[model samples]
Target: MSDTYAGAPAKPGTVSARISPVGGLDVLSRNEVARLRGASGSGLHALLRRCALAVLTSGNISDDPRAILEQYPDFDIQVLQQDRGMKIELSNAPAQAFVDGQIIRGINELLVAVVRDIVYVSTQLEQVGFDLDASAALTQSVFEILRNARILKPQVDPNLVVCWGGHSISRQEYDYTKLVGYQLGLRGLDICTGCGPGAMKGPMKGATISHAKQRRRHNRYIGITEPGIIAAESPNPIVNHLVIMPDIEKRLEAFVRLGHGIIVFPGGVGTAEEILYLLGILLHPDNAGTPFPLIFTGPRQSAAYFEQIDRFLRLSLGDEVARHYQIIVDDPETVARTMIKGLEKVRHNRLDTKDAFFFNWALQIPLEFQLPFRPTHEAMRALQIHHERPRHELAADLRRAFSGIVAGNVKEEGVQAIEQHGPFVIDGDADIMRALDKLLQAFVEQHRMKLPGGTAYEPCYRVLNA
Candidate 1:
C-alpha cells in the first residue's frame, strides 16, 4: 500500500485521492467489491457514498441530511479489489478530511467502517437471508452486526454508558454534557453515543481529558449510527469504534444491548424517540426485574426541558414510568456517582442472571420495538397514541410518533415526504395530544428541532386532539 498521495488538482473545498484502508476493514471478497462498485440504484454504492461522505465531513454542524450531498455534489467513492488488499478511491471528497494531501487517519478508519457495515449488511445479512422479522432473529442480527464490527468484548465489566441528545444545542448545554462525561471518565467508564456533534461529541471530548489524567488505556469511544441518520449526524472525531447498523431499529437495539446504562441530555424529537424506545422496552413485564440504569440530566437552564420530558413520559406512559429513571440537574459529579452505583447494580444483575457482561441478553424487547418504522405520511397518521392501551404498547406508538417527527425534521426521505404532503397529522387522546403539542412547541422555542443557525424549523406534524 502506497502512502504517497496521488490525485487530480484539488477543487476549492474538495480533493480527489486514492487512499488505502486504514482500520476496521481492509480486505473484501471479489463479490463484495463488485457489489460495492455497482452504481445502479439497487446496488450498495449509493449507500456507501452517502455514509462515507458523512464520515469524511465529521463534526459538521448542519443537520440537513441533503445539505452535505449538495455541498459535495460530485463526491464519489469506489472500492478497488487488489490481490494484497482493498483500496478506496475517492473523487471530489471533502477537503477537510485530508491533511497535507493524505486522508486523515481517523476519517479513513471511519470511511472503512462505512464500507464495512454497508457491505456486511447487504451481502452477509440480507443476501445470506437472516430472518429479520422475528424478534429473536432481529436481535440476533443486531448481535451479529456488532460482533462483526468487533464491538462486543468478553470478560468486560458493565461500564459502557450510552448518551443521547440533540446535535443542535446551546453552548451551555454542550458544556454540561462534557462535565457529565468527564465525571464518568474519571470513574473509568467508556462512552457510547449516536456519534454526532453537540451532546454526542461533548461527553466523549470530556472523557478523553479525564481518561488521560487517569492514565486509562484502551478506552472505547464508540459511536453507533445507521444509514438514514448518518448524513444528518456524522460521527464525531472522538469516536474510535464506529458501527453502522442497517436501520434505526437495529441501531437503537444495539445501544440497549451493548451499553449498561443510558444518560439523556436536553434534546428534541430524536432524544424523545430514544427515551420512549428504552422506556417501552423496560416497561415490558418480562424486563421488569432487569436493572438498566437510565438518567435524565442537564444544566440548570435545561431543567425545564427534563421536566417537560418527565411530564410527557408520565402522561403518555403513566406515572409509574418515572421509576425507571432519575432526574439530575446541573450536577455532573452526582450524575456520574449515581451512574457508578447503577452500573454496580447492573453488574450484580448480570451475574445473578448468568447474562453476558458485554451484552444484555436477559432484557425482553418486543417485536414492535424491533421492527423498522418508516415515517410516511399515512404511517405517521395511523399511530395509536391513546392512553387506554397497555402502557408499554402506548409507549411503543409514542416512540413511533417521535421517530416520525425526527425523520421529518432531518432524515432525507422523511423531509421529502413532509415537503410533498404537508405536516403529518397526529391524532390521539385530547389530553395526550395537548401535552405532546406543548412539549413539541417547547422544543421549537428552545431551538432543539434544528441547529440554531439554520433556517427556522417548520412544524413537521399537526397534533389533532380526539
Candidate 2:
C-alpha cells in the first residue's frame, strides 16, 4: 500500500492514505483478500469499491445512486495483505473523512465493517452449516451475521429500539424524530436505523446528546443497511456500529430479530414497506401471542401521514392489523415512555418464553418474509396483491410492490431497469389498487417520493386499473 495521495484536478477535497483495521475486522483468508483485490469487472471488487466509497463519502445527502460516483469518479480503494495483517489503501477519497491527513477513527471502523460483512456474506455463510432455503437456517444466518458483527449482546436487556422512517423527510418531522430519540436516550435506551440521512440520522443524533447528558457510556447506535442502497443513502456520521446485511429481506429480518421494539415516523414507500413487513409477520397465526412493541409517531403536522398509512394498511390488510401497533402524535416523551412500557412487556414475554434478550428468538418469521425479493419487471408485474389471499400473504406481496418502488426510486439496478425497460406495471384487485394509488399519489404530493431538490419526481411504476 502506497502513502502517496491522489487528488482530482483543482480539488483539494480528495485524499489518499493507507489504514489498518481498528476492531471488527482484523484478518482475512488469502482467498478473501484475493477476491477483494480482484479486477474491477469482478463482482467482489466492484462491491468492495462501491461500499468502501460509501464509507469514505459519509454524510453525503443525495439519494441518486450515481451521485457519489459522478462527484468522485477517480476514487478507488484496494485491499492489501501485509505480513502482519490487512490494510486498506484509498486514493482520491473524500477529504471530510480525514483530520490532518489521518483518516477519522469512526470512518475507518465503518470502512472495516463494510469490508467485513461483504466478504463474510460472499465467501463464508454458505460453505457449511448454512442453508438459505429453510426458514430456520435463514434465521440462523441472520443471527450469525449480527453475532459476527459483535452486535448481539449476551447480557444486555431489551433496550435497543429500531427506528424506521425515510431519508427524505421534512424539517419538522426530522426534529420530531430527534426529540423522540432524545427522550429514549434519557431513559437509557439505544437506537438502530437504516444508516441514512433525514429521519434515519435525526434520532441517533438526538440520542447522542441525551446519552451524554445522562452520562451513558458505550451506548449502541447501530445502523443496518444493504449494499444496493448504501451508495445512495450513505451511512450517517452518527452510526458508530454498522452492519451491512446481504439483501433487503435479510436487512429487514435483522431489524426485527435484534431490536426490542420498533418506532416508525412519517415516511414514503420504503417506510410503508417496513410497516407492512412487520405487520405481515405479526399477522401470522404462530405469532398471535407475541408481545412486540410497534409505534407510529411524528409531529402534529405529520399525523396525516400516519393516518394515510393506517388507512392503507387497513384497506390492504384488515382492521385486525390495527391490533399490532399504536399511534402517538406530537408527543415525544409519551412515545419514549410508551416504548419503555412496551419494552417491559417484551422483556417479560422473552423471559416467560425463555428467549434471549439480545435477539427476538421466539418471533415466527414466515419463509415468505425471509426469501429474497428481486425487483425485476416480471417480478413486479407478477406480484399477487389481491385481498382474496391470506392477510399475511397479501401483506408480503404489497411489501414487495413498495420495495420495487423503493428500488426504482434509488437503487442503481432498479433505476437502470426503469431507464431501459420503462416503468414497472403493477395491477391488482380493484379496491386495493385504488387505495394503493391514492396512498402513492399522496406520497408524491407530500414530496416523500424523492429528495425535494432533485429532478421532478416521476412515477416509477404505473398502477394499472385492477
Q: Count the backbone clashes (under 3 Å) in each candidate.
A: 0, 0
**Residues 1-466, candidate 1, lDDT per residue (tens digit)?**
2243465665688888878887868478878888888844456888889999999999888899999999999888889987777788888888898888878888888888888888888888888787888999899999999998999999988899999998989999999999999999999999999999999999999999999999999999999999899999999999999999988989999999999999999998999999999999999998987889999999999988898899888888889999999999999999999999999999999989899998888899999999999988889889998888988899899999999999999999999998998999898999999999999999999999998885678999999973
> Cα-based RMSD of the predictions, in order?
1.4, 1.9
Number of the predicted model whose TM-score against the real structure is largest: 1
Once fitted onto the true fold, the runs of candidate 1 whose alpha carbons sit more than 4 angstroms away are 1-8, 39-41
Pairs that collide in candidate 2 are: none
Q: 1-466, model 2: which lDDT tens digit per residue?
A: 2244444332567887878778558588878888788843347888888888888889987889888988888887888788988878887788988887778888989998999998888777866657688999999999989998999988888999999999989999999999999999999999999999988999999999999999999999999999999998999999999999989999999999999999999999999999999999999999998999999999999988888889889988989999999999999999999999999999999889899998888999999999999999999999998878999999999999999999999999999999999999899998899889999999999999999895799999999873
Evaluated against the true structure, the overall lDDT of model 1 is 0.91
lDDT of each: 0.91, 0.90
Candidate 1, pairs of clashing residues: none
